[model samples]
Target: MSKAFTKEEDGTEKIRLDDLPQSTHPNLVTPSGLADLKARLAAARLELENLRARPEEIDSTMAIAVAERDIRFLESRISKAILIDPKDHSSGVVEFGATIDVVNEEDEQLTFRIVGEDEANPAQGLIAPYSPLGVALLGGETGGTVEWQKPSGVVELEIIAIRFE
Candidate 1:
């Protein structure tokens, strides 16, 4: 028999499942980030409950295991969350939860909001404060320049505005 068919000491074959990667950086969050985390935790709990109630479903064991793992992860994240109100920070410089308006060398204007890693969605203009562009923009005042490396080349951005709201 192949090793794949062998059972472990527990008398059960190990199931290989991929878990979500946790960020090592500080678990900082804006008020919105905190809210999102709570919502996620609640959703995960509901999902696990649903999975447990449907034991007859095909692959329900795997689903329940995955859901349980997700719940644990979400719970950990929620417990570690440090809430930071954006309004408390200075608006003159770019920082976490600051909405920034920048113009590139090409004069193309773009906007981004610096947020917590858990809340970051680049496609939605939300970036993690530890991200390259976010780090470069931090502490930068309006009219200051920041640069970030891209596959094509390093791009420079000029800060036009920073708002805490």
Candidate 2:
């Protein structure tokens, strides 16, 4: 998975399944995935060929593709990047794997499914506990609000409740 994510502000609808504790996936390569990655590597190599032929004409698109390929290469090293144990419980206090219900500044209710960096999905409302908003909520008790700095200005969030899935 890619570390970069496009977060949507006006999005809604979420369900927190369970908190994953540890990763128990086998540390081995998937033969099919390896084969597919090899093909992509070959295709990228071909693109590089065309790029090399016109060194002065290569643009940012090709450059970005190369960079993305590099990232995928490194990511392929791990068999299971994000593993949810499906049994992690933070014991009431908001921890790394806790699911929280937050009300935004507009008084609209929202829920964010917090996960690890590998499993962070903004669309699914899964945020990394280490992120800015996540940091503010860590170790916080219910009924209190989490304050943080946003691009527009300072923002405050109230933790209505926490649901453990």
Candidate 3:
């Protein structure tokens, strides 16, 4: 019989999965952000252990690949986290971990909390410190005006208040 007709051994082929890329920017994180990263890393490690212990319960190769990738990514992120306590920063200036209240030219009030990239959720008002609005707001004091260059156009935001958590 031709070799093609024979059953191949289980370990005959190997599958390689590439690691997730790490961000080039500094891993600036709030105290909560660092805690969240650590928690996620712990969860990933638990999941990896579970996957390895029960390889016979599922598609072991693909499942193991995903779990391992998550572990590596979370571990790297946790390792790179630089925790910055909001209370330790300047009280009056808009800096990282500062909660800011601003008003646009249209008189619409908005609030944003500057946080780490990993903890940024724009819809919920959490913004990355390097984001356009965050950059414009940083270093600003109460009653200051900043022009944010958005893709639509430049929008001016007036600083109403700034507080640290």
Candidate 4:
């Protein structure tokens, strides 16, 4: 192959990574979720700066690209965030940011907090509003039963308590 037809001789060409895709859902966020997004953006900015400052130390092209991409994603998410304080919400029914205690048909007690997509950590009992359980629990009053459509099957859960912080 001729060197004239090649574009990777000295590896001087700047690699432009593709932008991260944005979500189509509404950007609903609790107070804590918004704070987390801001913190992530700050960290990404710091990482990018550090990588640029010490570029000669290693091949940081990929690191810098990743950091820049994360910064873009976090900034976009923060910009579109609709902060909702749970304290301002009514306590009569389940809603976003509501912490609920439920008893399943198997008599197992479980707790979950309805949160935004960015703040969802199901393993930690935090669920997104669009999740099957969250969808079923939302608007449910305490002592009411809701059916959760899990991938395995439908499970009935009785809401024992509802609280907001």
Candidate 2 lDDT tens digits, 1-165: 323323336452222222224334332222333444456566766665665566455364445445445545534533353344323554667765667888879998888765655456778877766677778777767888888677788788888887656
Q: Candidate 2: deviation at residue 54, Å? A: 25
Count of residue pairs whose backbone atoms collide, per candidate? 0, 0, 0, 0
True-structure Cα RMSD, model 3: 5.6
> What C-alpha lDDT do the candidate models reach, one value each?
0.84, 0.59, 0.84, 0.87
Clash count, predicted structure 3: 0
lDDT of model 1 at position 17: 50
- Model 4 residue runs over 4 Å out of place are 1-11
Looking at model 2, report the run of 10 residues with the lowest lDDT sum. 12-21
Per-model RMSD to reference: 4.0, 15.7, 5.6, 4.6
TM-score of 2: 0.50
Off by over 4 Å in 1: 1-19
lDDT, candidate 1, 82-145, per-residue tens: 8888899876988788999999999999999999999999999999999988888889999999
What overall lDDT, based on C-alpha atoms, would model 3 receive against the true structure?
0.84
Question: How much is 18 displaced in model 1, in angstroms?
Answer: 7.3
Per-residue alpha-carbon lDDT of model 3 for 1-165, expressed as tens digits? 111222237543323467777888888999999888888888888887887788576476566667777788878888888888999876678999999999999999999999999999999999998899889999999999999989999999999999887
Query: Which candidate do you rate higher for lDDT, 2 or 3?
Result: 3
In model 2, the Cα lDDT at residue 153 comes to: 87
